[model samples]
Target: MEILAFIYFDPMYFVYVGPALLIAALAQWKVKSAYAHGNKYNASSGLTGAQTAQRILDAYGIGNVSIEAAKTFLGDHYDPKHKVLRLSPEVYQGRTLSSVGIAAHEVGHAIQDFKVYAPLAIRNGLVPMASIGTQFSFALIFAGIILSSWMDMPGARYIAVVGLGLFGATVVFQLINLPVEFNASSRAREILQQQGIVTAAEDKIVGKVLNAAAMTYVAATLTAILTMLYYASIVFGRRD
Candidate 1:
């Protein structure tokens, strides 16, 4: 028999999930819109994202990190494991504020790694568990629900509890990640100003782009939290 979670529920699941979904959609829209708006003009410094990131790293006395152009669109990221900063083509070579800001934000991660930022360290530490939890939590929950009432298997409750615990670790990971992202953006804005890479007006626009990017993280974390709560309510609501 296919498991329908909890057999039944009393808590209003949609009430929580609907808003989170809406926010996530809005965040995604903002990211695209903000990027498009910021991409229209070249920065006064005429430096591309890759160049700007290299300068910022040099400014911070971070000499070991390498920058590379990633062919993927909007695929910018900092790989701490390899000490490489990967910028999408648009960011790597584009002279627009959006490109610079986005690239700088990833470099901010590299900065955090160099400084041994506590929250980032914690977030990194949780990566393995969070990755496992994200991939397997739902499957385990469904399995547990399916076997809950099966007289032959008495371990259903334990399975469900383990699933919930794993998912809870994911939630913890998201919470820790928030500060890491915010701090990175803050550092990016400061560096842009201190280095005169962007004018005052341009810095404001950079903030807009970076803030929009941050909202996507917020939306994701919010959705994860609410979904976890909804599942938890159902899983624990029933007593065997």
Candidate 2:
């Protein structure tokens, strides 16, 4: 009980806990604000998400990729495995600025795939491990600490270290994701402008929507990195 209490009150733990929650809340706010603004401006192009995706793909000369409509909202994504682009129902059918901006974002992934973007490739490779890391890292760390208390050995420290390493993978992946997402948004904006798909007035709204959406990913990455640092400090700092 004493050890656990000590760990709980450890200054490093508070450091990690505070930033993680703050970043998460910021991400949520940015996502909601972007979505709302995009919906409000709506596009004059009359191009559904599906159409926008197709146009972008075609412009990039990516004839091999396929675009499909998804059933969820803001669920648009590109699957490199199948070379398919999936857009959520709202995006697939809606002709709003938000929908078009988002649609272009997915298409940007297709462009990345065609060009073999290094960051996207790295992110793809890390997805499976990161997914597992998310599930087990925290659990293992907590269990290791408890076991260490029960057995009176340093096994808890070892376990916590391993957990921290796994969680670190998640942070690395999130960092890589930041560039990929931001680049995709940049491509989307450029394509929208180049193709005259949106007028000058509408372009402003598109930029706002894309920028807001990008903030969510930035927030997520910041939170992940901060979390890794927090755990590392707790497990290792106390040893000295």
Best candidate per lDDT, number?
Answer: 1
Q: All candidates' TM-scores?
A: 0.93, 0.90
Report lDDT (Cα) of residue 80, candidate 2.
97
Q: State the lDDT of candidate 1 residue by residue for 90-164, as single tens digits.
A: 999999999999988998999999999999999999999999999999888767766765544757867877888
User: Which run of 10 residues does model 2 get worst, by summed lDDT?
Assistant: 231-240
Query: Candidate 2 residues 36-72, lDDT tens each?
Result: 8888765777788789888878888899998888887
Question: How many steric clashes between backbone atoms does each model show?
Answer: 0, 3
Clashing pairs in 2: 42-97, 43-96, 43-97
The Cα local distance difference test for each model comes to: 0.88, 0.83
Off by over 4 Å in 1: 1-12, 150-155
